[model samples]
Target: MTDESAAPVSSGRRGRSGGGADARRAARTATTITQAGFIRRAIKPYEPFTDEQLQLIEDNAEIVLQETGIDFYEDEEAVQMWKDAGATVTQGNEPRRFRLRFPKGLVRSLIKTAPREYVQHARNPANNVTIGGNNTVFAPVYGPPFIRNLDEGRRYATIEDFRNFAKLVYMLPSLHHAGGTLCEPVDVPVPKRHLDMIYSHIKYNDKPFMSSVTSGERAADSVAMCELLFGKDFVDQNCVMTSLINANSPMVWDGVMLGALKVLARANQACVISPFIVAGAMSPVSTVGTLTQLLAEASVGIAFTQLCRPGAPVVFGTFAASMSMQSGAPTFGTPEPAFVTFGAAQLARRMGVPFRSGGGLCGSKIPDAQAAYESANTLWPTLLSGVNFCLHAAGWLEGGLASGYEKLIMDADQLTMFQKFAEGVDFSENGQAMDAIREVGPGSHYLGSAHTQANFQTAFWRSSLADNNSFEQWQDEGSKDIVVRANAKWKQMLRDYEAPALDPGIDQSLQDFIAQRKAVLPDSMS
Candidate 1:
C-alpha cells in the first residue's frame, strides 16, 4: 500500500534532501506532534493467578514482613515513625540500623488511604496522564549512564544528550510522560546535575515529569522548583510530579530511598515504591519466591509513603528480572519475570493501588536483533499485565547501562502500535463496512469504493520508522535498515524541535533558583 499524500521520493537522492517546496511541506507536517491521548485500555488485563494463589502470596508476604522485619538503616526519623505507627522496633546489630516488623495486615491497612487513581497534571493540561484504573502512561528510558548511536558508538552521556532526548520524547506523541534522568549527565558535577535534569524537563517538554530522588535535599529541591513553575499552593494540593523510589532488595529500606519518599509524599507528589530485584541475586530464583519478596518489599515502601502523609499517591511497583545462573548477569524479557509482572499487577489491584512494572527491557549491548526481540517480549506483557505507569518504555540498551538513540525511535514506534492495539476493536457502524462490502460485491475490489476512499487514510496505523516497500523500491531508495532510518529520524526530530512556551517570569525564577543552589551546594564528581 502506498499513500498519495506522501511526498514523491526522488530516485536520484540517497537520503531526503533539505530542498524543494514539497519536501519542506512534508518535513513540517511530519515534525508536527500528533494529538495522541493517554491510553485508556479497552481490553481486560491478563490475570494468571487464582484467588487461592494470590492469597497465599499475600499471606507469605505478611509473614516475611512480620517475622523477618525490614531494616531501616541510618534514619532515626523513619525508625521513630515506624515505632509511632505501632510497629515493633528493635535495635539492630550495626549502628544506625533499626528493624521494624508490622503485625499482620498492618502495612495493607496503612496503604488503604492512597488513591486508587490520580491525575498527574502536565504543564499543558491536555497532556495530563491518569495513573490507575484502566489507563496506561508511557515514559522514555531513565537512569542510563552512557549514550549510544550509529554516529557516536558509545560514550558517557552529557547534558546535551539529556536535552536532545527530552526534545525527542516531547515530539513523540506516543509517550505521555517526560521521564526523569533520561540519562545521567556525567559531564555535569554529580551534586549539580539534578538541577539541570529537572530544568530540562520543564524547559523542553510540557508533559508530566518526574523529579529527583537522589537525596532528601535534592527531592526537596525538586519540589521547590515545581513550586516556582506551578505555584507552592498548587504543588501542595495537587499531584504535579511522580518520582521513583526503589527498595533495596532482600527486604531493605535504606535511608536514601526512605528520605526521598518522605519528601515527595509530604508534598503530595506521587512516588513509585518499586523493589529493584534481580532473581537469584537480590531475590529468590523461583518465580513464586520472587513474587513473595517483591510484595513484602513493595508493601513496606508504599506503607511508608502513607505514613509520611495519608492519601499521598503511590504506585505498587516491582522491577524483577531473572539472572543467569552461570554468569550472574541480569536477564530481561524472560518468562519468569513476565510471570512476576502478571502476578504483581494482580496483587496491586487486590491491594487497591496502581501497578507499575515492565518496559522495553533487555540485556543487549547494542540495538540489534537481541534488543528488538527482548524489548518486544517485555513490552507485550507490560500492556497485558495492565501496567499503569511504564518507565524505560523506550531507548533502553546494554542491560540499561546505555541509552540507544536508534533504539529509542524504534521502541517509540512500537509504543504507538501498542496504543492503537489497546483501543481494541472499533465495532462501530463504520467498522462493520456492510455498505463497502455490498458496493464491492463478488470480491471485485473496494480500493475505489466510496467507503474505502473515506476511511482508508485512518484505517491502518502507519509506521514512521518501518520500510514496507517492495525490494525494487527499497533498493532504489537506498536499501537502508531500520537502525539507519532511526538514526536519521532522531536527527531530523532534533532539528525540528520547538520548545514549548514558558512564562518568562517563571523561567527567570527557575534560573535564579538553580544559580543560587549551585552556588551553595558543593560540587562532587562522584
Candidate 2:
C-alpha cells in the first residue's frame, strides 16, 4: 500500500530522445505512484443498536446456538473439537454432518484467545497494515470469475487477466492489500490455479495479500510459497497472509472451508470467519433476524479457529445482501444490508475481534450510473460502520460476478476521498486560518490571500477521474466520460508498472518449489 515499489522514484523508464511530444509524455507518466497509508478512522463508529438492543441480539444468537445448533459437515476433526469443548452433538440426517449445540459461554470462552488486532506484514515493512481497532484496509475485488472491459465485454478470466489486475492493484495507491483471487483464473487447470494466483500477488505487489482457501492443500501451498519468499522463521512468527474462510449459510461449515481454516490457524496465519449471507435465501429476511444468525454462525467459526490453535488471528466477517423477492437475485447497496452491517460491526467489537464488511458493491451489469450509485451507498456504510478490512473495495461489478476494468479505477479514486474524510476536521493553527479571515474580512475574497497562497495546493481533495473543466474546453478535449477516462488510466498504469524487487536466490527457490509441486500433482481439471 506504500510507495515502496522495489524500484526507486527516479529510476522509471523514459522514452527515447526523439521528439518533444514523446519526451513530455514520458515525463508525465514518470512520476512515481505516491504513498497511501491505510485509513484509521478519527470519527466514532455509527452503532445503530442501543446496549439493551445489542444484548437482545446477543441473547437470541445464543438461543440459536443452543436450540437450532450449527452443522459441521465432513470434518470429523472439527466435530471432535466441538465435542471436546463441551458442546452437545447429534448426528444429522446427511452423512458426515453433525449438529453442534454449544452451551451459552463455551463459544465465548474459546474465542477469548484471539487477538483483538494484529499487523499483517508485507514484504516491504512500509506496506504493513494493522487490522482491527480504528484501522481500515482496502483490498480489491475478490472471487470474480469474469473480467470486463469496454473493448472485450465479459469473458472467463485467464492467468494473464489475473496478472493484469495484480499489477493494477500494485500501482493504484488507494488499495492497501494485494487481494487474493483478484479474478478466478479459469483458463488455468482448477487444481493448479491457486499456485498461479498466489505467485501473481507476490511477484506483482509487495503489500500484504491473502491466501488460497479453495482447499487445504492449496492453503498449504500458499504457506510454503511464503516460506520461500520470507524465511520460514519469519513466516512462523509473523502473519504473512490473511485468507477468507466462509461458512455455508443457514448454520453449516463445510469440509473445504474448515480444512483451509485449520491449516491457516495451525500455521499462525489470519483468516476471516465470514458467513456468505444472502438474506431471505441464506438466512432470515428481517434485518434483526439476519443479525442473530450472522452472530451465531460467525461465533462458531471463530471459536473453531481458537480450537485449532489458540491466539490465532481472526476477523468477524459478514457478506450480507438482500434477495429480490420477485426474481430471487441478490441485491447490493440496500438499506437492509446496511443495517445488518452496522449491527454486525457492533457485535464484532463486543466479541473483541476485528470486523470485515462492505465494499464498492453493486448489482449493476456495467460501470454506469447504477454502478456508481450503489457502490457509493455501500462504501458510505462501510466507512461509518468501522469495518477494519474491506474486501471488494474496488473493481467489483455485476453483483460480484465480474471485475470491471473501469470500475476499479473509479472506485480507487473515491478511496482517496475516503482517506481524506477519515482524517476528520483539522484543527491546527494553519487549518484555523485566522490570518486569512482577517485578510479577507467583510465581502472580500480569500483566493489570493497570504494563507490561501500557503495552502492552495493542499486545501482540498482532488479527483483524478472527474473532469471539472468548462463546456467549451470539454468539447475541445473530446468530452470523455469517467469510464473512458478510467479505461485510459488503467492502460497507462500497466504500461508504467515496474515489478517489485525480489531476491534472485529466493525467487529461484520459489520457482523450484512450484515446479516440483506441479510435477507431482496431477493435471486434474477440477
Candidate 3:
C-alpha cells in the first residue's frame, strides 16, 4: 500500500560485543580514529514517524492543492502552457486558476532524489560551507524592507545603506554566508536590479553567497551573469549559488518563484525552500495545525525540485512565526519562536535535509536589555536541536523589517559563543583527565599543573561579552552597556575593514556594468 516498506536500511549492527571490539580495531587500522569523540557520540536519537502520520501529511497537501490551487504563470505564454497541460482554466475575462495535481509516487521520488546534505563553496576552497551536521551555522543578509513607507519602514533601505551593511558583513567573523543583495537596491530599476546587486556582493565579500530570487527572468539572468564572471561549471564545481523559493501556505507556488527554482536547478545551484507560514494568518492558530500546513507546503516544493532536477541540493527553510493578534503582524521573538526553531530542526533530521532558521531577530526597537534577552534565548533550542544552518543571524530589528549595525555586532558575539557550546566535550585518552588527576593527587590544586595549563583553553567555554576584568580595572575603564560597547565595535570595524582584492579587470568591468545599468533607470527610481 505504501513505499515505506522499501526504505533502505543500514547494514551494520549496533551494540557492544566481542565482534564489536574487532570491528573497532579494524576501523582504527583504516585510519578512522575519532578526535574529540564525545561530540560524535553525544547526538540525540531521532524519533520514529508512523506510516499513518506520513500519509496524513500527503493527504493534507493534496487537499490543499485541489481546494486552494496555487497561483503561477503570471505571464501569458506560461498560462497557455498550463491550459494545454489540462489544468482547469478561466478565460481572460475571469481570473486564472492554477491547481496542481500531485500523485503519491511523485512525493516518494522527490524525497528519495533530493540531497540531504551538501556544501556551499566560497572563493577560498577552505571556506567551503556544509549544512546538516553538528550545529554548523551560516548567516545570510536578511531584511529587504518589503513594506516601505511605515515609520519603521522609512529606514527600510537605500544603496548607500546596503554598501555600508555589506562592509559590516565583510568584517563579521561569525556570519559565514553573504546573502547577495542584502538590501533592496532602490537605485536600479526592477529589470537590472539583480546584476547591480550581485556586483556589490562580489566586490564586497569573498564568502559563500546566496543568489537573489526575485523573479524567473532575473533569476536566469543572475545565474548567467555569475557564469560570465566566475566561468562555466561555477554552479556545479563550486556550489556557488543558493537561491530561495518561498511557498505560500497551506498551498501555493507562484509562477515567478517556481520558474526561479527551474533556473537555479538548471544551473546546478543549491536551493533553500522557505515556506513562510504565519500562524493565524496563512495557517491555523494551533501549533500542530500550523506545522501540518508547513509540511504540506514543503512537500510541494520538494516534489517540484526533484521533478526539475533529481539529486538537487535543497535545504528545508522553515521560517515559521505566529501572527500577533494585537498588531496583526507576524511576531518574531516569543515562546513560539523557540518552538519554530526546535520543531524545524527535528523535521529536517527526520527528512534528512538541512534545516534553515532565523537568528538574532529579537523584534526590539533598539539594542537594549530586551534585545539581548530575546536574542540569547531564541537560539539555544535551535542549537541543541541540531539545526544545520541558521539564517538572519545578525542585523535584524523590529520583527525582521530593519537591520541594525550594533545588533549585528552583538549577534556575531552570540554566534561565536554558541559555536563554542556546540563543541560539546572532548573524549580523547588525555581529555578524560584521569591520568592527570591521579598525578596531581586528589586534594592538591591542579591550577599550577602542566596538564591544567595545557588544557585550560579547551576545558572551559569563553565569552566575548561577559566581563572578566578585575573590579579595580573595570572601575578605572568605566563599565559600559553592551549596546554602547557594540556600537563602538561596529564603528571600529567600519574604520579598519579592508575590501577583499578581486581580479583587477573584473572589478572595473563589474563597476562599469553597474554604471551602465544605473544610467537607464527613470529619474524617480534613481
Highest TM-score scorer: 2
lDDT by residue for model 2 (1-526), tens: 3223422211112211134443345445543456597998898899889999999999999999999999999999999988988999999999999999999889999999999999998876778999999999999999999999988999998888898898899888899999899999888888888888887787677789999998999999999988777777878888989889999998999999999999999999999999999999999999999999999999999999999999999999999799999999999988999999999999999999999999999999899999999999999999999999999999999999999999999999999999888889989999899999988999889889999999989899999899999999988999899999999999888777876655444555666788888888878788
Kindly indicate the candidate among 2 and 3 with the higher lDDT: 2
Clash pairs of candidate 3?
Answer: 72-255
Scored against the true structure, residue 159 in model 3 reaches a CA lDDT of: 63
Q: Point out where model 3 deviates above 4 Å.
A: 1-59, 62-94, 133-135, 144-156, 185-193, 236-238, 470-472, 515-526
* lDDT tens readout by residue for model 3, 390-484: 77777666677667767777787777767666655668887798878887997898888878888888677665665688988866877765666
Clashing pairs in 2: none
Q: Could you estimate the TM-score for every candidate?
A: 0.93, 0.94, 0.81
TM-score of 1: 0.93
lDDT of 3 at 108: 45
Of 1 and 2, the candidate ahead on TM-score is: 2
Off-target runs (Cα >4 Å) in candidate 1 are: 1-32
The per-candidate count of clashes, in order, stands at 0, 0, 1
TM-score, ranked from best to worst: 2, 1, 3
